[model samples]
Target: AQRVTQPEKLLSVFKGAPVELKCNYSYSGSPELFWYVQYSRQRLQLLLRHISRESIKGFTADLNKGETSFHLKKPFAQEEDSAMYYCALGGRNTGFQKLVFGTGTRLLVSP
Candidate 1:
């Protein structure tokens, strides 16, 4: 079975402070990790992907095979960055390219 686990349900931080959303996965084969964010009433969008190794909206996540973790990070937290963040895992082993998402973490940035 494949699973994505985000231990923190909520991460509160002050403006300009650093932020980190922890994500861990359990899978038998190589996995593709991604971060999805939903702001206000908007639909969920991809924030970053491990294979891309690119940063979007000042956020980045790295996949650590040894630890089976892909944690999202940002040096500074902005009010607009507050959103519902989800960690997802996908791989060929799944047969149909289905993504398994974690419960999700809500980021709260306060002034």
Candidate 2:
């Protein structure tokens, strides 16, 4: 079985402060990691994918194969960035898409 873990359930940071969300994964095979965020009263959306190598909303995450980690980072955070963030692992068997998500971390950006 594969699992994704977000040790922090809640992260409170001031606006304009740097932030980093820790994520760890356990899997036998190669893992496809992703960060999904859900804003206030908004649907969950992809923040970043390990394969994309792109930054969204001023946040970026790089997959550390050796450590089995994919931590999200942002040089600066905004009040609007307050949201529920989840670390997800995507794997496949045959034609089926299997995913395991972390408990989720709620980021509170205080003004």
**Candidate with best TM-score:** 1
Residues 44-94, model 1: lDDT tens digits: 999999999999999999999999999999999999998999999999876
Candidate 1 ranges with C-alpha deviation above 4 Å: none
| Tens-digit lDDT string for candidate 2 (26-110) | 8877678999999999999988999999999899999998999999999999999999999999977212576789999999999
Worst 10 residues of 1 by lDDT: 91-100
What TM-score goes with each of the models?
A: 0.98, 0.94
The candidate that wins on lDDT is 1
Clash pairs, candidate 2, are: none
Against the true structure, candidate 2 has what lDDT? Answer: 0.91
Residue 106, model 1: lDDT of: 100
